[model samples]
Each structure stands twice: as C-alpha cells, then as structure tokens.
Target: MLLGCLPGLAAVLALALCAGGVERSVAASGRQVVARPAAAHKAVRPHIVPRSVWLDDDTRHAQPPPRYDDRVIAVFVHHTDSPNGYDCADAPRIIRYLYAGQTGSRDWDDIGYNFLVDRCGTIYEGRAGGIDRPVTGAHTQGFNHRTTGIAALGTFTAGVPVPKEMTDAIAALAAWKLGLSGTDPRARVRLTSSNSHSRYAAGASTTFPALAGHKDGYMTSCPGAALSALLPGIRETAARLQGRH
Candidate 1:
C-alpha cells in the first residue's frame, strides 16, 4: 500500500512540475502578455485640427466667402519681411494686421492671400474665405482680381531659399486647386514675359502647371527669384497630392 501511494504521489508531482515548466517556458519565449496598468490604458493621444480652423471659428461673429468675381486665374506668393521671419508662428497675427490695414487704411476688409504658408509649411486661411468680399488687394499688379494669392512668411529673395517642405505644400495646394478648377494638374503654369493666358504646356509627366515669379500679368517680384525658381517642382508635387500620375 505504501509503494502504490508513492507511485501515485510521484505522478501528481510530475504533473505539477510539467504544468509549472510549461508556464516558465512560455514566459521565457516572450509569449506572455503583460496587462497594462489601468491608468496607462486610458492614456491615448487625440486627433487635432489645424490652427487655420481656429482663425475661422468665431461664434456668430464669423465672415462668409465671397459670391462674386472669384475667377482665380493665378496664384501669387509673398514674404512678410517687415516683421521678420522669426515670427513665422505668428503669421495669422500678421494676417490680422494686414486685414486691418487693408480694410482700415487701404480700404479693403481682410487679409490678402487666399492662403498663407508659414516658414514651417503650415497653411493658414485668408481673405478669400471672409465676408464683405474684397475685389482688390496689394498682392499683384493688374491681376489681383484674377489671381489667388498665396503668401509664405519668409523673405526668400536672397536667403538660403524657401525650404523644400514649403515648396511641397505650395505644390500640393496648387495641384489640388488645379483639380478643383478643372485645369490639367500637370501643365506648366507660368506667367511669361510673352504671354498672359497662363501657360500649361511645358511640364514633366509628374508636375502641374504653376505661375512662376515675374510671370503673372504684374510688374513686381511676386514670388521673388530664389523661391520662384522652385515653382515647377512645387507644382509637380502639388499635382501628385491630387493623385495624378
């Protein structure tokens, strides 16, 4: 009877050992799942909208987009140099200043650009979305009525030039706009010294047409020299964002 009980006890000890060993092997093989702490499980980041949305979010005090004369034949670029490039993050504030001056001083009621691109490539909403529509702006000569203005915060005339990221944003926006306007996204959009109808023929298979600096129907340095040199590239990138080949 003692021997029989001994065998039974051994069998029970072996089963316990096997079960324990299997658990240890699972832990050692890195297959054991660790339950997160209760507090940790609740910590997750939320999605965020852009700062441009904040500019347009005025409860009942908001302005509306214009209903007339928005042909948007071209896009112009500018730099906010008077206040300096270091304040790129405060571009919306500058927009407010411009809108005040354009309205109060120059007799227009809002910021000039349809869009403003900051040094860090952040795009902000501008005048085209405002109420009491502006038919005139100081963005370009002979074409402010027909052109869509897009300003970048940096003075890239002689500096190291506009960053490629900025060019990318400009291109993407331009491309998307082209798609909406029923224009060929891959066309060359340049205001030449010889033409006024916007050239959409001289582009690579991947790039969209964009009006280059000094090409608009205006006489001023619209996008300047350095940054202007990158318009073709910008247009191409913008086209791709619209899912064109």
Candidate 2:
C-alpha cells in the first residue's frame, strides 16, 4: 500500500511544471488543491508575412545558418532609410531591394532586421530564422543578441508623419516578442555589449528600455526622431497587449 501511494505522490508533484492550471487530490485533508504555474505574461503572436514572401530562391543569397540566443528580452526599432512615399503593394519589392543592398554591398550574411513593418501596418519577417525564435540580428551594432530588431519600411526623420497603422503593428509585434520571455515592454533590462562600435564599450553592462530605439544601443539616428518620439506610447500599448498594466 505504501509503495503504491509513493507513485501517486510523484505524479502530483509533476503537475507544478505544467502551464496554466492543474488540480491535485489531497487525501489527508479530503479536499482538492489547485496547482498553477506562474503566469507567462505572453501575448498572442501578431500575423507576420514569411521571408519567402520577399526573398525568393532567385534572389536569396547563400549564407551560413542563422544564430540564436536563449530568448528575446528587448526590441530595437529602426528605419530602412529609404523613401517613404511608396505604395503598400510595392513593399515586397522594397524589402527585396533592401536585402540586395545588405547582402550584396554591405556583405552581411542576411538582412539585418529580424522584422519589418510597412506603412500600411503589414509585418514581414526579415531574417532567415523563425520569427518565434530569438534570432540574433545585425541591426544594432553591439546589442543584437537577446534582442529583436524591427525596421520601419521607410525613413522617419524629424517631423515625418509616422503612420498610425505602422506604429500599431510594431507595438503588437514587440508585445508578443518581449512577452515570450516574460519581459515588460515599459521596463528596463540589462544587456552586455558585444562590440565597441556601440555606445557602450564591449563587455559593458547597461540597462535599456525593453522596447527601445536603435539609438538606445548604438550610435545612430535610426528609427528616426519622429518614430523615437512615439516610443513611450508604443511601450504603453505593448504592455497593455501583454495584459500588463
């Protein structure tokens, strides 16, 4: 009788690792106990167009396999630095152009950004890796690992009228990506710099907003002034999406 009870006890202990809620029987107390895992604070993943939509085999470059980190704790926003007055229907061509420039002239393994958002609010996967995975990007100089890079499809210099649709999509993507690691969009996270080209020296540790601009980690005007000004509101929106206050 004792040996049989031991196996039942072990099964009940394993319930703690399960996500959501689980119930266990308490024979001694003649009551049921509920065991729930800690809340993940995850948000529903926003729709993202796959890389194949932009980079076909004809245009695809032969690059090494993608690299990854444990999880994404932050997001670095950027702009493609191209003209903004483009038809949303032409977004795929624009992305392909950017990909050519990066992999051809810049000699990067792949497109730097992990994701890109068009002015019409369409989100597209930029890099080769899975969007749900923490694929290290080349968007930020030193803080690429453990962070996601989201590029606005066009330039957003000061006084530019950033599209509300675009910003909304960015917020949703950020919320989902950051939530995967239980990171709050409005909070700060500590990260180590891997390159001296960044604002922080190599090996330096610093704290930055979980949702931040490219300038936050590197010395650049990327994600531009107009977009940078919207970051606070974006953070709030992202947090709300994640079910955070």
Clashing pairs in 2: none
Model 2, 179-209: lDDT tens per residue? 9888989999999998687788889999999
Model 1's alpha-carbon lDDT is 0.45
Off by over 4 Å in 2: 1-37
For 1-245, candidate 1 gives per-residue lDDT tens digits of 00000112123211110000111223566887655322210111112123355343441223344534443334556544332345655766655554444444344434555666766666766655432233333354333444456666555554555777677666655554444443444454433222232222222121213443433434445455667777767756655565655
- C-alpha TM-scores of all predictions: 0.57, 0.85
Clashing pairs in 1: 103-108, 171-238, 172-238, 187-209, 189-209, 189-210, 189-211, 191-215, 207-236
How does residue 206 of candidate 1 score in lDDT?
19
Error of 2 at 61 (Å): 0.2
> What are the lDDT scores of the predictions, listed in order?
0.45, 0.81
